[model samples]
Target: DMNDIPPVFTTVPRPITLDDDVPIGTTVINLVAQDSDGTSPNNQ
Candidate 1:
């Protein structure tokens, strides 16, 4: 019944090195997150 806990990021993106030639709108890194409340949607 204690589902008031807030969502937290389980894993975050680390420092990344990109080339100067990198194009725009390119994904640099991906972030991962999760929620403990089973009743609430996994909307991290």
Candidate 2:
């Protein structure tokens, strides 16, 4: 998985309220990221 990610990405803390209660087996990642490619990733 590390090889699939870029090295120039930066991320900061950004928390969001749960849209809905997740199931027991669910996995979630809540983060705000900024990439050198000029795209912004939100609440991932």
Candidate 3:
């Protein structure tokens, strides 16, 4: 059966604190999302 399952956030970023002199372009955290459908386009 083909079912459309919505993507879920497998990894969620936690609250972060930045200093006043933080860089303009800085990566705070990384997030991960997964789809249960396990198919192209939808999975991605």
Please tell me which predicted candidate would have the highest lDDT against the true structure. 3
Clashes of each: 0, 0, 0
For candidate 1, the per-residue lDDT at 18 reads 98
* Estimated TM-score for each candidate: 0.50, 0.28, 0.55
**Evaluation by lDDT, superior candidate among 1 and 3:** 3
Give me the runs in candidate 2 sitting further than 4 Å from their true place. Answer: 1-9, 30-44
- Residues 1-44, candidate 3: write the lDDT tens digits: 24588878988768988899989888878899777886676666
lDDT per residue (tens digit) for residues 1-44 in model 2: 12334534356655756657677766566455543433334212
Could you tell which candidate, 1 or 3, scores higher by TM-score? 3
The lDDT for every candidate, in the order shown, is 0.72, 0.47, 0.78
Find the number of clashing residue pairs for candidate 1. 0
Candidate 3 has what TM-score?
0.55
| Residue 28 accuracy (lDDT) in model 1 | 86
| Residue pairs clashing, model 1 | none
Please give the ranking of all candidate structures by TM-score, highest first, separated by commas: 3, 1, 2
> 40, model 2: CA deviation in Å?
31
lDDT of 2 at 24: 73
